[model samples]
Target: MKRIILIGRAECGKTTLTQALRGHKLQYHKTQAVNRHDVVIDTPGEYAENRELARALILYSYEADVIALMLSATEDYSLFSPNIAAGATRPVIGIVTQIDQENARPDRAEAWLRLAGCKMVFHVSAFTGDGIEELLTYLDASSAADENV
Candidate 1:
């Protein structure tokens, strides 16, 4: 599997999505540091929220096959700047979480992600198992493609 690194603000569902992707029961767990899994790296929200720690994400991206920038559909604004992923050496994908929330605005989130330079964007709800399969399938295909190269 390709190792995907997830970056996002607090409560953006990186951990929840990680668990869901691994086929584990959903659990609430605070990620204080970089949580490295077999195929995922869950970073604390601070790494993306605080400018001082933002460089760490760029550094960590070196270890990942793909860099995923996540945003909650409920967020009214984007923490990521336009073209933020332009500097990444690896493929950058966007993940819009919390799409099941009543106040979710997935379209706005997707637009922000596109502005942030993601090559592809996915809207997913870890709680409802929505869009997870497609994301996983993409990951699998990406990993296989990488191996062929």
Candidate 2:
């Protein structure tokens, strides 16, 4: 089992994405870090929270083959890795949520990721079930490729 840490802006469906992956509602907490038995952990994006979470995630990413970065369509700054398609050591993918919003543009987001240097970026809407499966497909394939490599 791999450990996937979900980090993104508040109200960016981090909880929803975890639930969808686990097929149940995700439990939130104050002191918890990694969820057990293949459970994905969720954390608040507070500066202190992120500073702490980032360390744990960096370590976890060392063991896991992938780091799924969540990005908010409604949140302009809800991104990581300073503009890249994939990150070092592990394959990274951009999860675009809130696609139902009026300003959520996948094309623009794709361009941003591409410009940022991300080799692969996928879009998803946790509410409408729009791009979840597609993202899953990409993640699975990328992870498989990563494993094979």
**Candidate 2 Cα RMSD after full superposition onto the native fold (Å):** 3.9
How many residue pairs clash in each candidate at the backbone level?
0, 7
Candidate 1 lDDT, 34-143, residue by residue in tens: 98999899999999999999989988888998899999999989999999888778888999999999999999999999999986999999999999999898888844
User: What is the per-residue lDDT of model 2 for residues 15-63, given as tens digits with 9 covering 90 to 100?
Assistant: 7777666556545434343543364656555521366555666665565
Candidate 2 local Cα displacement, residue 20, angstroms: 1.6
Cα lDDT computed for each candidate against the true fold: 0.92, 0.59
User: How high is each candidate's TM-score?
Assistant: 0.94, 0.70
Clashing pairs in 1: none
Q: What is candidate 1's CA lDDT for residue 99?
A: 99
RMSD of every candidate to native, in Å, equals: 2.3, 3.9
| Cα lDDT for residue 66, candidate 2 | 56
Model 1, backbone clash pairs (residues 3+ apart or across chains), number: 0
